[model samples]
Target: MPRPARTTPSRRALLGSAAVLSLALGGLAACSTSEETQAAAQSTAGGSSTYPLTLTSPFGETTLEEKPEKVAVVSSVDLDIALSLGVVPVISPLYGEAELDPWETTALEGLGESDLTTYDSTDGVDYEAIAAAAPDVILATSGWTLDEDYEQLSKIAPIVSFQGADGLTGMTWAERTAEAGKALDLAAKAQEVVDGVAAKFEAAAAAHPEFAGRTYTYAVIHPEQITYESYDGSDTSFFERLGFTLPAAASRFSAGNQAVSRENVDVLDADVLLVGYPFGDEGLLTRSALESDALFQQVPAVAGKHYAVVDDLVASPLAYPTPLSEVWVLDQLVPVLATAVAGS
Candidate 1:
C-alpha cells in the first residue's frame, strides 16, 4: 500500500514511518541504564524536551508524563536509534551470540555499559523482564507484534509505537529515528544524527562521482525466487544516498517485497546489480541456482561481472540502514560498489 503524506504528529498521532528484517527479524534485547549513560544521554543544544508530551501508536494513545529517562526497546533498530541519540534504554532485545551491530556495541561501550540484563525475544516479549527494568517508555516502533502486545506493555509504561508503517517492514530508518527522537524528547538530536549519517552518504557519493545518475537494483538471492528491494522502500535510500538510482523496471515490485521467478530475472538488469545472500551456505546454494540460470546470466551487469554479492551481515544496512548500520557498512560497501560500477 502507498503511504500517506506525513503530518506533524499530534500528542496522540505519529509523524514518521520503518526498517527491515535485521531489526524486525533480528535479535531483541532489553538493556539497563547507568550513571555514565545518564551523562551520555545529554542532548546537544536545541534537543531538550518538556515533560508530559503525549504520543500515539496504532494500539492507543498515552502521554509521556516526563522525559523518559529509562526506555525499553523491543528491536535492535530502535536500540540503534536510541543509542545514536545518546540515550541508553533500561531494556532492549537480547543480542545473544550475534550481539549488536559494531556501531551499537561500540556506542554501548562508550556509554560505560559493561553488561546488559538481556532476554530472548524469540519466545516473544518478556514483559516480566521489561517490568523488572522499571522503564518509563517502550520503543516498539519497529516491532512486528506491537499491536497484540501493546496493551500488556502499556500496563508497564507508555508505548511509543510506530504508526503508518507497513507490516514487518515497519518504518524507514529515517522515520524510525525521527519517531524515536520525538519519543525520547530529543528531536533535535535525532535530526542531527540523521544529518550526520546523510553527510557520510554525501561524502561517499561525492568521493565517487561515477555513482551519480547510475542505475542499480538491490535484491536478495532466495532459493526458488528473487525478491527485489524498492528504491522507495527497503532502505534503497542507502543507494539513493550514495548517488544511485533504481530504474523503474528494476524496481519490479513494491512494499519492499514481491518475488520474481528466475524466468523474469531480466528485470534486474541495471548499471549495477547488487544481490545479498543469507548468512550461511543457504545463500551460496541459492546464489548458485541464480547464477546458473540462463536468464540471469544474460543480464548485462551480471554478464559483465558488474555486480556485487554480499553476505547477509554486510547487507543489514540495505535492510535497515539505521544510523549505526549505515556507518558500520559504508567503508565495506563503497569499495564493492565502486568495483561493480567500474564495468570493465
Candidate 2:
C-alpha cells in the first residue's frame, strides 16, 4: 500500500489574516507604542500563542505573532520549509528552471496548490494576486527587496525580510532557514530536521567507499554554456551542511562566480561530475550532454563516463531546507554515482 499523506494545516485556519498582516507590515496602528511592540515580540519562540514575538533575521529584526498561520513565501525554499513544518500558506511562488519550465508541477505535489496565482521574480511580484489571497505574513529577503515593492507588500500584511546581522547577509541557506524558523518559533524542529539530514548524509558517506577518496564537482549549467560551480563557504549551504568534498578545479574561480563560460569547463577536473538538472532533461548530466558539447566532451569525466545526473528534486536551492530533500539526495544520487563509477 502507498504511504498515507502527511497531515497539514489549512491556510485560513493557521492564523488570523488581518491581525497577521498588521504585525508583518509594521502597520500595527492600533498598538503603536514601543511597549506594545516589545510585548508582541516576547510571545513567539516555539508554541501556539497570541502574543507577538521578535526575531533576528539575516536582513535585520522583525517581530511576528505566535503560530502565524497565513504565510506568503517569496522563495520556494521557504515554502518547502514551511510545508515541512505543516504550515501551508495562501500563496508560494516557484523558482529555478524546474519551477518555470514545463510548468513544474511535480515539485508542488501534496503542497495544496491548485491553480494558485504565480509571480515572476524578474519583473517583481504580483500584488493583485497577493492581495486576493489575503495573506497575513510575507516572508522574503533583502536580496529581492525593492523599496516600493516592500512598501506595497507591507500594505497587504506583515512582511519579514531575511537580512544578515553584522557582516552576515544570511548568504548561507542554513542561516536563512534558521532565521525563518526562529521568526515562527520553530527553531528546535528546524534544528532537528537539519540534524537528521546530517545523520543520513553520514550514513550514505560511510556506505559508499568509492566516494571517500574521490573529489566531485557540483555545477549548475545553463543553455548558454555557462557553468557555475560550488565553492566552500559560499551560498551553496546544503552541500556545505552535507560535508561533500568539492573538486579542486573550482578553486580557480572566485567565491561569487555562480556562472562560468564554456572555456572554464576544462577547469572542472574532478574524478566525478555531479551536474544539477533543474531544467530540461532530469538525467542530462548522467547521460551524454557533456559529450554532445565539443568543449565539455574533452573533460575526463565525460570521457570516462564519470558523470552523475542529479534529480531536480534535491538539486534545487528551494528544496534545500527540507529533510525529504536529503533523503532524495543520499538515497537517489549517491547510489547512482556509485554505479556509474563502478561501470566506468
Q: Using TM-score as the measure, which candidate wins?
A: 1
Q: What is the C-alpha local distance difference test score of each model?
A: 0.69, 0.50
Q: Using Cα atoms with residue i matched to residue i, what is each candidate's TM-score against the true structure?
A: 0.83, 0.64
lDDT of 2 by residue, 14-107 (tens): 1212112101110111211132322233333355323486644443344565556566776544555554444445665532111221112223
Residue 322 of candidate 2: its Cα lDDT? 40
Instruction: Give the runs in model 1 whose Cα sits over 4 Å from its true position.
Output: 1-32, 41-47, 95-97, 165-170, 231-235, 255-257, 279-285
Residue 51 in model 2: lDDT:
43
Give per-residue CA lDDT, model 1, range 1-344, as digits (tens): 21111122111111112221323222343344675656655636255666788878767888898877788888777777878888777766652334555577688777776555556664568899889889999988777677678888999999888877363455677788888788777888888888998899889999999999999987765443466765444456677878899787854467645676667778888899988765234332366767787888999999998978865556545455577778878878899999999975
Among these predicted structures, which one has the highest lDDT?
Answer: 1
Error of 2 at 283 (Å): 16
